[model samples]
Target: MTATQFRCLLACLPDPLTARVVRLQRYVLVSLDCTGCQEVGVLLKLALLSARAGDLPAAETVLHLAERTLRALAGHDHTFAPPRITRLHRPRPRPARSAAAPSPGPALAGQVARWTGTRPLVAATDASWKRGHGGMGFLTTDGRWGIGDWKVGPQDPTGPSKIIITELRAVQLLLSTVEARVEMTVLIDSLPALSYLWRWQSGDVSALPPGYEAPHLRLLARRVADRPRLRFQHVKGHSGHLLNEAADSLAAIARRRAPGFDVEARASDLVDSFLTSWNQQISA
Candidate 1:
């Protein structure tokens, strides 16, 4: 998108904050001779820091600055390039380096908040153990987040097994702790949890493997699933998203779970998204 068109996208903002912020960014880029992608990468980080509050306008202005810098660098080569903003997985209101290590539970929540900037998000995640597996059901809302992570070790090794049971525990935590009567979205990386929500919502309780019980979530799903507002969305793991990255990093530190998520949702992704949107406009 051209600088002007990108500026127009800030219509989503509340007031003149977009203009003021954009002007600030332009001033910052006044110096610096752009060349390799290294310079663009640095500017992109500043933009991500600027976008921390979910201010789309501030983000756009920051983006416009990046674009202008790139155009100057690319010279005769296309002036308007796509924005490649990367996302970070940060705890909500990222704490100081000293507090970076949070108890697994709160640590995860903080990581999620830092990413999406939402205080509350439902999560369905599973952990693999030597015996079997464990799953967690967590909700972050209204500035407070809680989690119930349950792992099922090698047991009767029968129906439902550890994964299902652990997942059930997590789901219960979400329904029981969340006080809001309204539906909310949960971010999860587990397919089992997603299918579980779908099955319970659809009233296919029998779909669950034998010897297992959903307890409260099955009922909760029945009531909230149809609300159209309550739902869960899956974000690919290790996608370089700021919060996602932090979550994975912390999880790695905690569980030593290696072979991290594939897509590392970095700040560049956001920049890329901006550039793609910008390019579309320019080419259009």
Candidate 2:
């Protein structure tokens, strides 16, 4: 049967939960022969859809399957490969950034207020793309940090992945470190990225997010759905914000090192120095 036929049958199921599980199973079937980051990507999208539909059991099951698939394939030696999707649609290009790009709409204030606390834990995330390589990094004011490159495997035929995708990936990495159910705030520099995420969190998931970043965005959406207290704050890039500059610098470092970079051994004084510089400048 065709994929459309299969999906139609799933939608006709009486129990929404059952239908969600079946849809997840369909992704698992696709993953059987698919060997790459693409397989994991598909599974994550399924999980995200299930979460948005309010089917936590189904989402968790798919997430578990994805984890198992990654573990099973961990020992294989392979290079980057283009995903074998049936139809890869290119999203329309977004317009250039305006000099005075308006702040996210007032609706975002209401959407964000539901998830914020008086003093939420805060972190800054950034992504960088150079020479077709993508990297993302995040750092909290209290010294927590993460840095990593995209999993495109260097055979990225779709050209460089969107910076928004890398930024969301950094969000995923940063949030993954937080304890479940706790309120958190993530400071970001990309307005478009924030808009994309807000749209998804508000249940407008009909269209795919830009590039191959849907899975990452979906994962983040699920995290938000489960914990409504997580908030995202947009900060101006290159405005001498200490943590933001540090995360941006780390992402640049990750892109330069590509494929293999050590985060643990990287110097920490740069972040501290930037914070000092930002403070001294502000005082001046």
Model 2 bad stretches (over 4 Å): 1-120, 151-161, 205-207, 211-214, 258-262, 272-284
Worst 10 residues of 1 by lDDT: 104-113
TM-scores for every candidate against the unseen true structure = 0.37, 0.52
lDDT of 1 at 275: 32
Q: Residue 110 of model 2: what lDDT? A: 7
Candidate 2's residue-wise lDDT over 1-284, tens digit each?
22432342234223654443453444433433344445765775666555433356676787677656656666431223332334332222445555543211000000122222323366788988865567777766445565656545554533333666778777766665455676667889999888866776676653345345334456566665566676778999999777788889878766655222233345255555554564467569
What TM-score quantifies how close candidate 1 is to the native fold?
Answer: 0.37
